[model samples]
Target: MDLDTGVALSRHDDHVDPFPVRRAEPAHAVPAGRMGYDLGAERLLLHTVQSAEAFESLLTTGTLRPDPELAEEAFTDAYEWIHRMMAARLPTRGEGALWFWARTRRKHLVDTCRRSRGRVLLTCRVPRERVLLSHFDEWHLVLNKGLGMPRLPGESEDDAFARWEEEHDDFDARLRAAGMRDAPVRDWPADLRTEIEKSWESIFDRGNYGPFECWQGTTHALNNDEVLEAVRII
Candidate 1:
Protein backbone atom coordinates (compact mmCIF):
# COMPACT_ATOMS: atom_id res chain seq x y z
CA MET A 1 0.00 0.00 0.00
CA ASP A 2 1.18 3.56 -0.68
CA LEU A 3 1.52 5.26 2.67
CA ASP A 4 1.22 8.74 1.18
CA THR A 5 -1.88 8.03 -0.87
CA GLY A 6 -3.13 5.18 1.40
CA VAL A 7 -4.03 3.20 -1.74
CA ALA A 8 -3.03 -0.30 -2.61
CA LEU A 9 -0.44 -0.10 -5.41
CA SER A 10 -0.66 -3.68 -6.63
CA ARG A 11 -3.62 -4.94 -8.66
CA HIS A 12 -4.94 -8.45 -8.05
CA ASP A 13 -7.67 -8.01 -10.65
CA ASP A 14 -9.97 -5.37 -12.10
CA HIS A 15 -12.01 -5.22 -8.88
CA VAL A 16 -10.71 -3.82 -5.59
CA ASP A 17 -12.24 -3.38 -2.14
CA PRO A 18 -13.37 0.26 -1.75
CA PHE A 19 -12.84 0.09 2.02
CA PRO A 20 -10.72 -1.98 4.34
CA VAL A 21 -12.37 -5.28 5.24
CA ARG A 22 -13.94 -5.14 8.71
CA ARG A 23 -12.16 -7.94 10.50
CA ALA A 24 -14.04 -7.64 13.85
CA GLU A 25 -15.97 -5.33 16.16
CA PRO A 26 -14.10 -2.18 17.29
CA ALA A 27 -12.15 -2.53 20.50
CA HIS A 28 -13.80 -1.07 23.57
CA ALA A 29 -10.58 0.41 24.94
CA VAL A 30 -7.11 1.15 23.67
CA PRO A 31 -4.46 -0.82 25.51
CA ALA A 32 -1.68 0.82 27.54
CA GLY A 33 1.65 1.76 25.85
CA ARG A 34 0.01 1.33 22.44
CA MET A 35 -1.14 4.63 20.93
CA GLY A 36 -2.16 3.29 17.55
CA TYR A 37 -4.62 0.48 16.85
CA ASP A 38 -1.85 -1.85 15.74
CA LEU A 39 -2.94 -4.73 17.97
CA GLY A 40 -6.56 -4.72 16.82
CA ALA A 41 -8.51 -5.57 13.68
CA GLU A 42 -10.78 -2.49 13.88
CA ARG A 43 -10.75 0.44 11.50
CA LEU A 44 -11.85 3.79 12.84
CA LEU A 45 -14.35 6.04 11.08
CA LEU A 46 -12.87 9.50 11.68
CA HIS A 47 -14.05 12.94 10.73
CA THR A 48 -12.12 16.15 10.22
CA VAL A 49 -13.07 19.73 9.39
CA GLN A 50 -10.89 21.53 6.85
CA SER A 51 -11.03 24.68 4.81
CA ALA A 52 -12.27 24.63 1.22
CA GLU A 53 -8.71 25.23 0.02
CA ALA A 54 -7.50 22.16 1.92
CA PHE A 55 -10.29 20.10 0.38
CA GLU A 56 -9.25 21.27 -3.08
CA SER A 57 -5.66 20.34 -2.33
CA LEU A 58 -6.74 16.83 -1.31
CA LEU A 59 -8.67 16.54 -4.59
CA THR A 60 -5.75 17.79 -6.68
CA THR A 61 -2.81 16.10 -4.99
CA GLY A 62 -4.55 12.88 -3.79
CA THR A 63 -3.07 13.60 -0.33
CA LEU A 64 -3.43 16.15 2.43
CA ARG A 65 -0.29 17.34 4.17
CA PRO A 66 -0.33 19.62 7.18
CA ASP A 67 -0.87 23.28 6.29
CA PRO A 68 1.97 25.30 7.77
CA GLU A 69 0.45 28.56 6.56
CA LEU A 70 -2.82 27.90 8.37
CA ALA A 71 -1.01 26.83 11.52
CA GLU A 72 1.15 29.95 11.54
CA GLU A 73 -1.75 32.29 10.91
CA ALA A 74 -4.36 30.77 13.24
CA PHE A 75 -2.77 28.43 15.79
CA THR A 76 0.39 30.45 16.50
CA ASP A 77 2.71 28.51 18.87
CA ALA A 78 0.11 26.02 20.10
CA TYR A 79 0.30 24.12 16.85
CA GLU A 80 4.09 23.82 17.10
CA TRP A 81 3.89 22.69 20.71
CA ILE A 82 1.28 20.01 20.00
CA HIS A 83 3.22 18.71 17.00
CA ARG A 84 6.41 18.65 19.01
CA MET A 85 4.74 16.58 21.70
CA MET A 86 3.41 14.24 19.04
CA ALA A 87 6.91 13.85 17.61
CA ALA A 88 8.17 12.63 20.97
CA ARG A 89 5.16 10.48 21.87
CA LEU A 90 3.97 9.17 18.51
CA PRO A 91 7.07 9.12 16.35
CA THR A 92 5.58 7.23 13.39
CA ARG A 93 2.53 9.45 12.91
CA GLY A 94 4.18 12.64 14.14
CA GLU A 95 5.36 14.66 11.17
CA GLY A 96 2.74 16.56 9.17
CA ALA A 97 0.01 15.00 11.32
CA LEU A 98 -3.58 15.94 10.56
CA TRP A 99 -6.26 16.25 13.25
CA PHE A 100 -9.51 14.34 13.24
CA TRP A 101 -12.37 13.70 15.62
CA ALA A 102 -13.18 10.09 16.39
CA ARG A 103 -16.73 11.22 17.04
CA THR A 104 -18.01 14.27 15.17
CA ARG A 105 -19.52 17.02 17.26
CA ARG A 106 -21.84 19.51 15.61
CA LYS A 107 -20.64 22.45 17.72
CA HIS A 108 -16.98 21.92 16.76
CA LEU A 109 -17.90 21.67 13.09
CA VAL A 110 -20.00 24.83 13.22
CA ASP A 111 -17.26 26.75 15.05
CA THR A 112 -14.55 25.64 12.63
CA CYS A 113 -16.74 26.56 9.64
CA ARG A 114 -17.29 30.03 11.10
CA ARG A 115 -13.55 30.53 11.58
CA SER A 116 -12.47 29.16 8.20
CA ARG A 117 -15.34 30.82 6.26
CA GLY A 118 -15.63 27.98 3.71
CA ARG A 119 -15.00 24.58 5.29
CA VAL A 120 -15.95 20.98 4.62
CA LEU A 121 -16.35 17.87 6.76
CA LEU A 122 -14.30 14.91 5.59
CA THR A 123 -15.17 11.43 6.80
CA CYS A 124 -12.91 8.45 6.28
CA ARG A 125 -12.26 4.91 7.44
CA VAL A 126 -8.65 4.58 8.58
CA PRO A 127 -6.85 1.51 9.82
CA ARG A 128 -6.15 1.74 13.54
CA GLU A 129 -2.43 1.45 12.84
CA ARG A 130 -2.52 4.72 10.91
CA VAL A 131 -4.05 6.77 13.69
CA LEU A 132 -3.33 7.90 17.25
CA LEU A 133 -6.37 8.44 19.46
CA SER A 134 -6.12 10.89 22.35
CA HIS A 135 -8.23 12.74 24.83
CA PHE A 136 -9.16 16.15 23.50
CA ASP A 137 -9.09 17.80 26.94
CA GLU A 138 -5.78 16.38 28.14
CA TRP A 139 -4.25 17.55 24.88
CA HIS A 140 -4.72 21.17 25.93
CA LEU A 141 -2.61 20.45 28.99
CA VAL A 142 0.17 19.23 26.73
CA LEU A 143 -0.05 22.37 24.57
CA ASN A 144 -0.19 24.75 27.54
CA LYS A 145 2.38 22.81 29.64
CA GLY A 146 -0.16 22.67 32.43
CA LEU A 147 -0.09 20.34 35.41
CA GLY A 148 -0.62 16.74 34.36
CA MET A 149 -0.72 15.56 37.92
CA PRO A 150 -4.10 14.06 38.69
CA ARG A 151 -6.32 16.12 40.95
CA LEU A 152 -8.42 14.87 43.85
CA PRO A 153 -12.15 14.74 43.37
CA GLY A 154 -12.97 17.94 45.29
CA GLU A 155 -9.75 19.79 44.58
CA SER A 156 -10.03 23.29 43.14
CA GLU A 157 -7.56 24.59 40.54
CA ASP A 158 -5.66 26.52 43.21
CA ASP A 159 -5.62 23.49 45.49
CA ALA A 160 -4.37 21.21 42.72
CA PHE A 161 -1.60 23.67 41.86
CA ALA A 162 -0.60 23.86 45.50
CA ARG A 163 -0.55 20.08 45.82
CA TRP A 164 1.45 19.70 42.67
CA GLU A 165 3.95 22.24 43.94
CA GLU A 166 4.45 20.26 47.12
CA GLU A 167 5.12 17.00 45.23
CA HIS A 168 7.67 18.28 42.71
CA ASP A 169 11.04 20.08 43.04
CA ASP A 170 11.51 23.81 43.51
CA PHE A 171 12.11 24.45 39.79
CA ASP A 172 9.15 22.31 38.76
CA ALA A 173 7.03 24.01 41.35
CA ARG A 174 8.13 27.44 40.21
CA LEU A 175 7.44 26.61 36.57
CA ARG A 176 4.01 25.29 37.43
CA ALA A 177 3.36 28.36 39.52
CA ALA A 178 4.55 30.63 36.73
CA GLY A 179 2.22 28.78 34.36
CA MET A 180 2.62 28.62 30.56
CA ARG A 181 1.73 32.30 30.18
CA ASP A 182 4.93 33.59 31.78
CA ALA A 183 7.15 30.50 31.33
CA PRO A 184 6.55 28.45 28.25
CA VAL A 185 8.07 24.97 27.93
CA ARG A 186 10.88 26.36 25.73
CA ASP A 187 12.60 27.87 28.77
CA TRP A 188 12.02 24.89 31.09
CA PRO A 189 14.82 22.60 32.25
CA ALA A 190 15.67 19.77 29.86
CA ASP A 191 14.77 17.02 32.35
CA LEU A 192 11.52 18.73 33.37
CA ARG A 193 10.57 19.16 29.74
CA THR A 194 11.17 15.48 29.06
CA GLU A 195 9.14 14.57 32.12
CA ILE A 196 6.27 16.74 30.87
CA GLU A 197 6.53 15.20 27.41
CA LYS A 198 6.36 11.75 28.97
CA SER A 199 3.24 12.77 30.83
CA TRP A 200 1.64 13.89 27.58
CA GLU A 201 1.63 10.31 26.30
CA SER A 202 -1.35 9.75 28.55
CA ILE A 203 -3.44 11.80 26.18
CA PHE A 204 -4.02 8.59 24.25
CA ASP A 205 -5.55 6.84 27.26
CA ARG A 206 -9.12 7.87 26.30
CA GLY A 207 -10.03 8.49 29.92
CA ASN A 208 -12.15 11.46 30.91
CA TYR A 209 -10.42 14.43 32.46
CA GLY A 210 -12.59 17.12 34.05
CA PRO A 211 -15.60 17.95 31.88
CA PHE A 212 -13.98 18.00 28.44
CA GLU A 213 -14.89 15.29 25.90
CA CYS A 214 -12.33 12.83 24.58
CA TRP A 215 -12.70 12.43 20.83
CA GLN A 216 -9.48 13.46 19.07
CA GLY A 217 -7.20 11.48 16.75
CA THR A 218 -4.20 12.20 14.56
CA THR A 219 -2.91 10.63 11.38
CA HIS A 220 0.26 11.35 9.47
CA ALA A 221 -1.74 12.29 6.39
CA LEU A 222 -4.95 11.49 4.56
CA ASN A 223 -5.28 10.60 0.88
CA ASN A 224 -8.17 11.10 -1.51
CA ASP A 225 -8.72 7.34 -1.74
CA GLU A 226 -9.17 7.00 2.03
CA VAL A 227 -11.85 9.65 2.16
CA LEU A 228 -15.27 7.95 2.40
CA GLU A 229 -17.24 11.16 2.03
CA ALA A 230 -16.96 14.96 2.05
CA VAL A 231 -19.68 17.50 2.80
CA ARG A 232 -19.46 21.26 2.31
CA ILE A 233 -20.44 23.13 5.47
CA ILE A 234 -20.28 26.84 4.93
Candidate 2:
Protein backbone atom coordinates (compact mmCIF):
# COMPACT_ATOMS: atom_id res chain seq x y z
CA MET A 1 0.00 0.00 0.00
CA ASP A 2 1.42 3.37 -0.99
CA LEU A 3 -0.08 4.82 2.17
CA ASP A 4 1.19 7.38 4.63
CA THR A 5 0.09 6.37 8.13
CA GLY A 6 -0.91 8.63 11.02
CA VAL A 7 1.17 9.71 14.01
CA ALA A 8 4.48 8.22 15.07
CA LEU A 9 3.57 5.45 17.52
CA SER A 10 5.62 4.53 20.56
CA ARG A 11 6.63 0.88 20.38
CA HIS A 12 8.19 -0.97 23.30
CA ASP A 13 8.95 -4.69 23.44
CA ASP A 14 5.38 -5.97 23.23
CA HIS A 15 6.08 -9.16 25.16
CA VAL A 16 8.63 -7.96 27.70
CA ASP A 17 7.16 -4.54 28.46
CA PRO A 18 3.83 -3.96 26.77
CA PHE A 19 2.97 -1.04 29.03
CA PRO A 20 5.97 1.10 29.77
CA VAL A 21 5.61 4.02 32.12
CA ARG A 22 6.52 7.53 31.11
CA ARG A 23 5.47 10.61 33.01
CA ALA A 24 4.20 13.55 30.99
CA GLU A 25 4.12 17.02 32.45
CA PRO A 26 0.61 18.13 33.31
CA ALA A 27 -1.24 19.57 30.32
CA HIS A 28 -0.29 23.24 29.89
CA ALA A 29 -3.93 24.26 29.51
CA VAL A 30 -6.69 23.20 31.92
CA PRO A 31 -7.19 19.90 30.03
CA ALA A 32 -9.96 20.15 27.43
CA GLY A 33 -10.60 16.37 27.13
CA ARG A 34 -10.06 13.12 28.97
CA MET A 35 -6.58 11.72 29.38
CA GLY A 36 -5.61 8.40 27.80
CA TYR A 37 -6.92 5.24 29.46
CA ASP A 38 -3.36 4.55 30.56
CA LEU A 39 -3.58 7.63 32.75
CA GLY A 40 -5.44 7.49 36.08
CA ALA A 41 -7.63 10.49 35.36
CA GLU A 42 -11.42 10.15 35.25
CA ARG A 43 -13.30 8.86 32.19
CA LEU A 44 -16.59 10.45 31.10
CA LEU A 45 -19.78 8.35 31.17
CA LEU A 46 -23.01 9.17 29.33
CA HIS A 47 -26.68 8.21 29.50
CA THR A 48 -27.82 7.81 25.91
CA VAL A 49 -31.55 8.23 25.39
CA GLN A 50 -33.89 7.79 22.41
CA SER A 51 -36.33 10.68 22.59
CA ALA A 52 -36.87 14.25 23.72
CA GLU A 53 -39.07 12.92 26.47
CA ALA A 54 -36.41 10.51 27.76
CA PHE A 55 -33.70 13.10 27.29
CA GLU A 56 -35.75 15.83 28.97
CA SER A 57 -36.47 13.54 31.93
CA LEU A 58 -32.76 13.23 32.61
CA LEU A 59 -32.50 17.00 32.42
CA THR A 60 -35.29 17.41 34.95
CA THR A 61 -33.45 15.08 37.35
CA GLY A 62 -30.27 17.04 36.69
CA THR A 63 -28.72 14.03 35.02
CA LEU A 64 -27.96 14.87 31.37
CA ARG A 65 -29.28 17.03 28.52
CA PRO A 66 -28.72 17.13 24.83
CA ASP A 67 -27.04 20.21 23.33
CA PRO A 68 -30.00 22.46 22.48
CA GLU A 69 -28.89 23.10 18.95
CA LEU A 70 -28.11 19.42 18.49
CA ALA A 71 -31.35 18.29 20.13
CA GLU A 72 -33.30 20.16 17.51
CA GLU A 73 -32.66 17.13 15.33
CA ALA A 74 -35.26 14.41 15.66
CA PHE A 75 -34.42 11.10 17.34
CA THR A 76 -35.95 7.61 16.87
CA ASP A 77 -37.02 4.67 19.02
CA ALA A 78 -33.98 2.58 18.06
CA TYR A 79 -31.75 1.74 21.02
CA GLU A 80 -28.13 0.63 20.74
CA TRP A 81 -24.61 1.53 21.80
CA ILE A 82 -22.65 3.39 19.19
CA HIS A 83 -18.91 3.13 19.73
CA ARG A 84 -17.86 6.17 17.77
CA MET A 85 -14.27 7.44 17.76
CA MET A 86 -12.97 10.98 17.17
CA ALA A 87 -9.45 12.04 16.24
CA ALA A 88 -8.25 15.54 17.23
CA ARG A 89 -4.67 15.99 16.06
CA LEU A 90 -5.14 19.58 14.97
CA PRO A 91 -1.58 20.89 14.67
CA THR A 92 -2.48 23.80 12.41
CA ARG A 93 -5.48 25.02 14.39
CA GLY A 94 -3.82 24.54 17.79
CA GLU A 95 -5.84 24.66 21.03
CA GLY A 96 -8.87 26.33 19.50
CA ALA A 97 -9.46 23.45 17.15
CA LEU A 98 -9.10 21.02 20.00
CA TRP A 99 -11.91 22.71 21.89
CA PHE A 100 -13.99 22.96 18.74
CA TRP A 101 -13.59 19.30 17.81
CA ALA A 102 -14.18 18.18 21.38
CA ARG A 103 -17.42 20.12 21.59
CA THR A 104 -18.52 18.92 18.19
CA ARG A 105 -18.03 15.34 19.29
CA ARG A 106 -20.19 16.03 22.33
CA LYS A 107 -23.08 17.03 20.12
CA HIS A 108 -22.65 14.47 17.37
CA LEU A 109 -22.22 11.67 19.85
CA VAL A 110 -25.78 12.08 21.00
CA ASP A 111 -26.97 11.90 17.43
CA THR A 112 -25.17 8.61 16.94
CA CYS A 113 -26.53 7.32 20.21
CA ARG A 114 -30.08 8.34 19.33
CA ARG A 115 -30.24 6.32 16.13
CA SER A 116 -29.19 3.09 17.82
CA ARG A 117 -32.25 0.85 18.06
CA GLY A 118 -30.69 -2.57 18.48
CA ARG A 119 -28.00 -4.54 20.30
CA VAL A 120 -25.50 -3.36 17.76
CA LEU A 121 -22.41 -1.34 18.58
CA LEU A 122 -21.94 1.06 15.69
CA THR A 123 -18.24 1.92 15.46
CA CYS A 124 -16.67 4.48 13.14
CA ARG A 125 -12.97 4.07 12.37
CA VAL A 126 -12.05 7.65 11.64
CA PRO A 127 -9.90 9.67 9.26
CA ARG A 128 -6.39 8.32 8.85
CA GLU A 129 -4.89 11.82 8.76
CA ARG A 130 -4.77 11.82 12.54
CA VAL A 131 -3.08 9.23 14.72
CA LEU A 132 -5.66 6.47 15.02
CA LEU A 133 -6.01 3.85 17.75
CA SER A 134 -2.82 2.12 18.92
CA HIS A 135 -2.86 -1.20 20.75
CA PHE A 136 -6.55 -1.31 19.88
CA ASP A 137 -7.17 -4.99 19.15
CA GLU A 138 -3.93 -6.48 20.37
CA TRP A 139 -0.80 -5.20 22.05
CA HIS A 140 1.32 -7.47 19.87
CA LEU A 141 1.06 -5.11 16.91
CA VAL A 142 4.13 -2.92 17.39
CA LEU A 143 5.14 -0.08 15.13
CA ASN A 144 8.79 -0.65 14.35
CA LYS A 145 9.94 2.78 15.57
CA GLY A 146 12.58 2.80 12.88
CA LEU A 147 10.50 1.31 10.04
CA GLY A 148 6.92 2.22 11.14
CA MET A 149 5.33 -1.12 10.16
CA PRO A 150 3.64 -3.76 12.21
CA ARG A 151 6.18 -6.23 13.52
CA LEU A 152 5.40 -9.71 12.27
CA PRO A 153 3.70 -11.87 14.85
CA GLY A 154 6.22 -13.63 17.16
CA GLU A 155 9.10 -11.68 15.65
CA SER A 156 11.58 -10.18 18.09
CA GLU A 157 11.74 -6.38 18.09
CA ASP A 158 15.25 -6.42 16.64
CA ASP A 159 14.25 -8.87 13.92
CA ALA A 160 11.15 -6.82 13.13
CA PHE A 161 13.19 -3.67 12.66
CA ALA A 162 15.73 -5.49 10.58
CA ARG A 163 13.01 -6.95 8.34
CA TRP A 164 11.17 -3.64 8.12
CA GLU A 165 14.33 -1.74 7.15
CA GLU A 166 15.23 -4.21 4.42
CA GLU A 167 11.73 -4.42 2.89
CA HIS A 168 11.39 -1.09 1.06
CA ASP A 169 11.42 -2.95 -2.27
CA ASP A 170 7.70 -3.93 -2.13
CA PHE A 171 6.55 -1.81 0.83
CA ASP A 172 4.21 0.54 -1.00
CA ALA A 173 2.79 -2.36 -2.97
CA ARG A 174 1.88 -4.20 0.21
CA LEU A 175 0.53 -1.14 2.04
CA ARG A 176 -1.93 -0.31 -0.76
CA ALA A 177 -3.09 -3.92 -0.88
CA ALA A 178 -3.83 -3.69 2.82
CA GLY A 179 -6.20 -0.72 2.30
CA MET A 180 -3.88 2.03 3.50
CA ARG A 181 -4.04 5.51 1.99
CA ASP A 182 -1.41 8.00 0.93
CA ALA A 183 -1.90 11.04 3.14
CA PRO A 184 0.01 13.90 4.75
CA VAL A 185 0.52 13.67 8.49
CA ARG A 186 1.79 15.64 11.49
CA ASP A 187 2.44 15.11 15.17
CA TRP A 188 -0.08 15.96 17.89
CA PRO A 189 0.71 18.36 20.70
CA ALA A 190 2.24 16.53 23.67
CA ASP A 191 -0.25 18.10 26.08
CA LEU A 192 -3.32 17.22 23.99
CA ARG A 193 -2.10 13.74 23.12
CA THR A 194 -3.73 12.09 26.10
CA GLU A 195 -7.01 13.91 25.58
CA ILE A 196 -7.25 12.86 21.93
CA GLU A 197 -6.45 9.29 22.85
CA LYS A 198 -9.57 9.29 25.01
CA SER A 199 -11.53 11.79 22.99
CA TRP A 200 -14.73 9.80 23.60
CA GLU A 201 -14.86 11.30 27.04
CA SER A 202 -15.21 14.74 25.57
CA ILE A 203 -18.76 13.90 24.47
CA PHE A 204 -19.93 14.06 28.05
CA ASP A 205 -17.91 17.13 28.92
CA ARG A 206 -20.16 19.48 26.98
CA GLY A 207 -19.45 22.24 29.48
CA ASN A 208 -15.87 22.44 28.29
CA TYR A 209 -16.98 22.70 24.67
CA GLY A 210 -18.69 26.11 24.79
CA PRO A 211 -20.03 28.75 27.14
CA PHE A 212 -23.62 27.80 26.24
CA GLU A 213 -23.51 24.24 27.56
CA CYS A 214 -26.36 22.04 28.87
CA TRP A 215 -24.76 19.15 30.77
CA GLN A 216 -26.15 18.62 34.28
CA GLY A 217 -23.70 19.66 36.97
CA THR A 218 -22.36 16.21 37.76
CA THR A 219 -19.55 13.87 36.89
CA HIS A 220 -21.27 10.67 35.86
CA ALA A 221 -20.01 7.40 37.28
CA LEU A 222 -18.01 5.20 34.91
CA ASN A 223 -20.63 2.53 34.21
CA ASN A 224 -23.99 1.75 32.61
CA ASP A 225 -25.78 1.17 35.90
CA GLU A 226 -26.66 4.84 36.16
CA VAL A 227 -26.70 5.30 32.38
CA LEU A 228 -29.51 4.65 29.92
CA GLU A 229 -27.33 2.26 27.92
CA ALA A 230 -29.56 0.20 25.63
CA VAL A 231 -29.26 -3.34 24.31
CA ARG A 232 -31.37 -5.84 22.37
CA ILE A 233 -31.07 -9.56 21.57
CA ILE A 234 -29.99 -10.29 18.05
The 0-to-1 C-alpha lDDT of every candidate, in the order given, reads 0.60, 0.27
Residue 71 CA error for candidate 2 (Å)? Answer: 31
TM-score of 2: 0.19
Q: For candidate 1, give the lDDT of residue 5.
A: 38
Q: Write the per-residue lDDT of candidate 2 for residues 153-221, one digit (tens) a residue.
A: 577879966775676435445444544323211132333323322433333332323333333211111
* Model 1 per-residue lDDT tens digits across residues 1-234: 555533444335564444331111112111124233222337787778777788768766778888655554333445666676567655465355698877534555445545543466676777776777777766676655555666567778799779867755554565666563355566666677677766666666643244335467777788877887565543
RMSD from true fold, candidate 2: 23.1
- Predicted structure with the largest lDDT when compared to the true one: 1
Off by over 4 Å in 2: 1-132, 135-148, 172-234
- What's the lDDT for residue 185 in model 2? 11
What are the models' TM-scores?
A: 0.63, 0.19
Clash count for candidate 2 is 10
For candidate 2, list the clashing residue pairs, or say none.
1-172, 1-173, 1-174, 1-175, 1-176, 78-116, 78-117, 79-116, 79-117, 80-116
